[model samples]
Target: MQLAAIREARAAKVAEARRILATAETEKRSLNPAEQSAFDKFKAEITSLEADEQRATFMEDCERRALGDPVGDRSFSAVQRQVNVVEVIRAQMEGRSLSGAAAEFAQETERRTGRKAQGVFVPLSAIESRAVNTTSTAPELVPTIHRADQYIEPFRNSLLARRLGVRVLSGLSGNLSIPKHGTGTTVGWVAENAALPTGDMSFDGVTLAPKHAGGITEQSRQLIMQSSPDIEQLVRDDLSFMLAQAIDSALIKGGGTNEPVGVLSTSGIQTASLATLSWQNVLAMLQKLDIVNASAANIVASTKAKAKLAGTLKAAGIAGYILEGGKVGDLPAYFSNQVAEKTGTPNTGRVIAGDWSQVMLGIWSEVDILVNPYAEGAYSKGNVLIRAMATVDAAVRHPEAFVVADDLAI
Candidate 1:
């Protein structure tokens, strides 16, 4: 499957190269600077296709080994692993010869793929007093991109489900397929030559494709420039916090249209209807994890639900609060505003209980910063607009590991 995509992508580059040649042929002139650069890029990408094919082969080898299928050559580890993707990409965009670690990466990649390095370029922006942060997409006068080095966001705890030990896969690319095993081989007593039952584990898959998610920040020149010495950190913190909030919100209740499927929307997950945030309901939700065989678990609920549980009695005649000391049913409980207070009838909140480790978060890219230094309006007014983004997806390894209730009353 991945090979087909690679071939298609390679063919596209080849066609692009052909188109460049064909255009020059029709124009009856030598290739222009932009045309030549594009042609070279396409050529480089074509060579890299072979590496992608090898990568697919390596993945297929692992799958075959796991499924006990007939396996072939296992020599798919290329030297590209030593390369720093960000540095190489940045160097390529700057049109400068790579040095140090980047140069070594280029040689290794080119040698392994038998072609010069090239790829789909993603703009890497930096924090600085530059015109790139103008108000518009295109800058005012001169067209130039932005830059930054080792930019970092302010330190803070991420309230996302990841803190609950969810499995996080980072720096991934292309389409991914995660194999799921269900019900291993069964054993049954066989009586004196009687036929035995045949049973084997059923298999399924959780697929993750690249999806784009990002936000834009528009800043006045004065604020980014003269307002503070650490404007960069402030901007970064804002972007990081917003991005993290969006991801966390999606983890709880994404609709799966342009974003990833989340806990409430994942198919086959356990569900229950609760009209009140009571001890019985919380216990019922916890019991849903019986089949999960989890060593520990956690509960995430809406703020209102937390409030109600914190004030409600454990039982009809119980003395203590149902939720005491930030714990519910002896399990730690957390409340988030992202838990969707406007769900179901009466616009109630949501509550989830599960072995959080079964949650899988796939990150295709980190916080990608893009800046347009030349927006006419921003340049003239001394303003800048910053865009921060990341591509990610979420899935559940075992739907049964989670129980969700949207009927929780505040």
Candidate 2:
């Protein structure tokens, strides 16, 4: 009834051909003209139907998910979906099969270019929440009309780059390379009959590949078992926060190994040095981006940088603050606690401003989650270990489009 029918028909034809050969062998005779004709006909059908077996099967299975999800209103069908994060944690804690939607999504994920889920597959959509509160201690309940129970999203960073119109490439497979034209061919006027100037253009590529950024937390098995929305919300938020932070952090601070290269470490970007937080220093960062014809769009800054800019005046006893109403003058800005204060000799925090559109965020997989009930010390402690991983990579379409100021001080 499904894609299986097509494969089965091909298999049946092959089986019939094998039987024809077997009968001839049993009778100690070679194939006659009629037998050969029948065998060749069966072979032709199979050859026409053949393809990469796994990919063919997956393509046949692809279809819209018209059915409602068992958990919340979100559905994970052929199209990658945003999901209710809490139900995902519950499924792993309960030690059972995933919800209908998640299970089907997971099967689809394994079938193709979707993320490779090693455990309970939570679509990254689960954590791409609207709530931006970074505080983990508070639990806020918001009403919902679609589900039997209202859903609560996890607290997460005010993720900046994506909101600022950064390019997003999702559901990708294998290594990807984007070619960039570094220089254009030159044409110049010359004397008649003289040799013309020859110029060759240089090109470069922005390479993106799968990099695993993982976060882990230990949970009380008893607490998770209670199924209290509040308890689950907190646990789910913690897990979601882990995934969210990793992705956000990788965009600012490149994950050193086995992770994407972030703005701070990516070579060829504009850099500015500031002994202290000042309007001049901030403007200088943008100026570098400007010289390269890069549009100054949004800013991603550390919470410390936000505080300093908000509190410090352009000049002592001056009338205005550098930052107001979550903006640096006309430019919209975002802050993250992970943009840490440096402990180096100068002791500064990181601030990045750029044409955020040049930042390429490639997602190879969604949030892949696994809960281990038998983790060391888990059984004795009555807890389970929860680990979530996101397969992603970051590339700068034009490194010159970004500028970093990591030496800003209070």
Candidate 3:
């Protein structure tokens, strides 16, 4: 059978197994002896079908290899070994306990890395085929449109804390306490019986708890079989981009219930009266920061506000402050979609300017991924679901070091 047909047959087998399991669980009780035995039998058949699909795919890859080479000189044994490596790598990803050939591969990997194979990413140096053609005819050199390899987030540059400095902490959850010097001690040339005043130092307590950020998606078995590597990469990038956007949103305007507290939303941060992006207001916003932080401070605004500011510079009466290389005066300006452009009824916008180094972001846990081959959502479609999760938080170390211009006219 063709590779696609084999994949479809395996998927049909999986669907059958799921149907049996579902029917047996309709009463929400433990399966009887006969039902248990039948379910086990179905599971064994599904396993056998999966193995058959793998073999069929390997054989097709070998055929492609033979057709691509002018001499048709590729050993079946070599192709089989490459296929085994790929399968072992996939088993490692699925968090299954490897045995047989897969177990030997894991052992060799551990010997080389000095750590368990499960914790490390074992790269597949060689695969059976690199170029895949769906047509039955002999292969030809054809240009292919590949997606952008390296993923870049739209809001990455505007994440102040992430750009300037971030405190990477380990653990599932924790609290941070930062010491504050409230008042200076009294300095005096004491007389015979004088007493000196005591210096006052206080600490601010911040609770850091990791809240789960995750998503799941399903794809048909045929789709997965068609372009496994490309589909895997696409799924991974999508998950990463989704998390990046989430973190950016929380850092800009989080409610503080479970996520990071945003600088604009946090109490007691300095605010400049910037009803509009006039040259005067812009200067005032820069001046609002302390001299020490002013040199290091940067501005983050929405794309809409940036356009408005560009127009403000061209206005006839206004003293245009030239924006050189995405900067206004000495401060570097950045734009993000996360910033609000139209907040209130009066059509207000927001502008954030600050020493971003004072902002701290805590990443609590590494991303965890799980694959469920028998998910109900994909059961009828004969597909599987991939889920990924992460945990993180953000905090401004010193609110005074940052400034926000809120309710500004757009």
Candidate 4:
């Protein structure tokens, strides 16, 4: 009876094992032929377990080994051995999806950063012709049209060397010609049309072979091999630095912190109770401030009350404006066009405006404001505010006074 009971248990275990095998088989059908064979072999080994006790022991051993437990003995039962077992199968499945997303993000970042170096060749259209030999029957030299493509290789090499942090060794190509006085011997030719910018020398392919003497490591070489993104980034950085320098130079050249030299006076307000200030009086004040340019005066008026006070001060030969209060958005337009019109400056001018308290708290506060002791009430309590700080010139000279003259508030 004990033997019979064991037989029944074994039969039940075999049925359970068959169900697992069927599932694995279904999975195998989705795989290619080679993978299906692997699955079939594993299935066959599992199916060979003859007793329920043996099958349970085998499965438990497999679970332990799959969980990274040591399998000290190799001669264990086939069912107990962990073969083709996957740990973190879910993570492996998700990894494939993540790889695609990562690639797209990297590409977009590169684009936004403007990390792409481009090269173009400007070909020489004409060259001085050599005199024809009267004694020999020779054809006239055909001038080749130079295309920018010829320079691409050297530019790419320079870019690659920069990315790899390797020193570049470049040489110019010599002109290709045989010496007229030499004894019938042919001299080697030189490249004639290579003109690279300063810090980038033209490379002559015929006369000089490209070579690196030292400092090339395995890692650097690998970097150069995949240097496209690095080259692009270098170009982007170079352009930004150049632009910043240009802006700074423009600002300094316009006038280094000099107040706009122009006049300021109010007009057109006359009443017994109110202090009288007229538009004509304001214009006269602007004129007294030495604002001779009409365009400068017009822009200040155009900007109205939002005209940048600092720009106006700069125009009037003052150290710039002290911003007590004003709208921020109008400041740029007010100053930009006026600076361009009056000073012949290009592009938008920069302005920094702040409230009374913030200006006092700022690190560069002293550069922007001044206190007036005589004014009354809120006007007397005004704080010197830096309305605009630009790396470029302001639009209008005495723009603030001009705005006042034009009955504009800015």
Report the C-alpha lDDT of model 3 over 134-174, residue by residue, as the tens digit: 21223368754434343333423343335544444433234
How much does candidate 2 score in TM-score?
0.68
Give the per-residue lDDT of model 2 (tens digit) for 1-410: 33444554666576568667855764589999999999999898878666544555554434322333232233234335544455666687676776556676676566557445678666675565332112222346864333313445544456655666656776678898877788888899999999888889999888999888787777765556654555545555576567776676787777597768887778888888766777887777777865775666677788878888898787788788888888886678888776767778767887888766667788888778887878889868767787888888998777887888777774
- Ten contiguous residues with the weakest lDDT in model 3: 127-136
Residue lDDT tens for model 1, 1-410: 57656754675576568657856864589999999999988888889997898799778677756765321223222222333333433343345665654354334333323433223212111211122222224468988543233334344433647667766665466678977776788889999989888987898898887677777765664435433324444454555565776777677777567988888888888887667667777777766665454322677888788777788897778698988988876678888776768655578877787766667777666555455445777667655545666778888777887888777677
Alpha-carbon RMSD, each predicted model = 19.9, 19.3, 24.6, 39.1
TM-score of 3: 0.58
| TM-score of each candidate structure, all chains considered together | 0.61, 0.68, 0.58, 0.16
Q: Model 2: clashing residue pairs?
A: none
**What C-alpha root-mean-square deviation, in Å, does candidate 2 show against the real structure?**
19.3
Note the Cα lDDT for every prediction shown. Answer: 0.62, 0.69, 0.56, 0.25
Off by over 4 Å in 3: 1-161, 170-182, 187-199, 222-232, 291-295, 314-319
